[model samples]
Target: MHPDDLSAAAEVHRLAFVRQKQSEQWLASTLAAFPRFLCFVAEEAGQVLGFILWAQKSGFRDQAVLELDQLAVLPAAQGRGIGRRLIVQSLPLVREQLVRQGSSLKHVIVNTRADNHAQKLYRDTLGAQVEATIRDLYSADEVFMVARQVDEGARGR
Candidate 1:
């Protein structure tokens, strides 16, 4: 995503989680720290519907874990397949990045509220399985989900 998209992207995040808005500053910092190659924004005809931000972390396994740091769609645009598309379109690019770096992708992970309906999106779109739940982790119990040993080819698409 480009810096120009920050305001709209921040608005999408704010509207997506009304009570727990993520500041534009935080989003800007994340965008700056992670290359735009690892970020995907859903847009059409000059409007941004949503975005997905991912980051890579090293693990004990000889590969890296790709974590979904944030994924959100404007409340007005929800349930229109934007979330699913964001994930489906991201994996091959993610795998390409890993391959370009001569590294392997071990898993793709995400953490969300235990009761979040988006959990199903993660599971259905990315083949993620709930690994654990940490109670009261952040305003609510949080569920940790991971897709282990991902195929070089995308499956959830």
Candidate 2:
């Protein structure tokens, strides 16, 4: 996504995540980091329908990890698998980078508001696990539910 896409991206975020604060400059700066940071926009006929932002980081245990920073789909675009496509398209790029760096990436991790319907989509449809509960972290009424991708090779456990 281009720098100009930030405003549209932020609008998508606003529609998906009510309390989150995001700025155009922040998105631009993030995109400046490019390959180190993965960002994607779902668009049709020049209008953005959704966007996702994520980063690659190395765990202290020496494992490569993809942290899904934010994912937002326009309300009108929901249920079309746009969110899934963004994730699916990005994961291989993240894995390829990890392999090039000689690190094993066991899973992709994301955290969402505990009560959000998106959590159900992640768990039941995407097959993510509830790794942990971060209590009262984001807000007094909000709980963070962590999820991890369980790919076949990472399954046994």
Candidate 3:
């Protein structure tokens, strides 16, 4: 996402994640993190409908583990495959950035509410499987899903 898209992306975040406050500030900080935190927006007709945040976990290495930090879509724009597209399209871009840094993606990890239907999307898109579940974590039970050996999966597309 470009710097100019921050406000619009922040609005999506605000609407998608109503429990989260300071949308603009949160997104701005994540954007400033740059290579450590790769942020991408899904837009159509010059409007940001959604965004995804992928973060490099731990320190830099020859192999990188990425966290699907956040995914948000405006309420009005939900169920349109925008979130799925963000994952499918931006992942290659993320891999390119990792390649430039002498690292290849090794794994992707995601933590989401256990009851969230997005788990199916993660499974279908990233080959992610639930490895653990933390009870009463962040508004509900949180499941940690991992897609291992992802570099061998063509960016998990």
Every candidate's lDDT: 0.81, 0.68, 0.91
Ranking by lDDT: 3, 1, 2
RMSD of 1: 2.3
Runs of candidate 1 exceeding 4 Å displacement: 59-62
State, as a TM-score between 0 and 1, how close model 3 is to the true structure: 0.95
Q: For candidate 2, lDDT tens digit of each residue in 21-79? A: 66566677788886667788888899999887877765323475666777888999898
Candidate 1 lDDT, tens digit per residue, 34-94? 5433777899888989999888865323487889888999888887998888888887887
lDDT of 3 by residue, 1-157 (tens): 8789999999998888888899999999999999999999998999999999999999888999999999988889998988889998888999999999999999999999999999998998898999999999888999999998764433333
Deviation in angstroms for 19 in model 3? 1.1
How much lDDT does candidate 1 score?
0.81
TM-score of each: 0.89, 0.76, 0.95
The candidate scoring highest on TM-score is 3
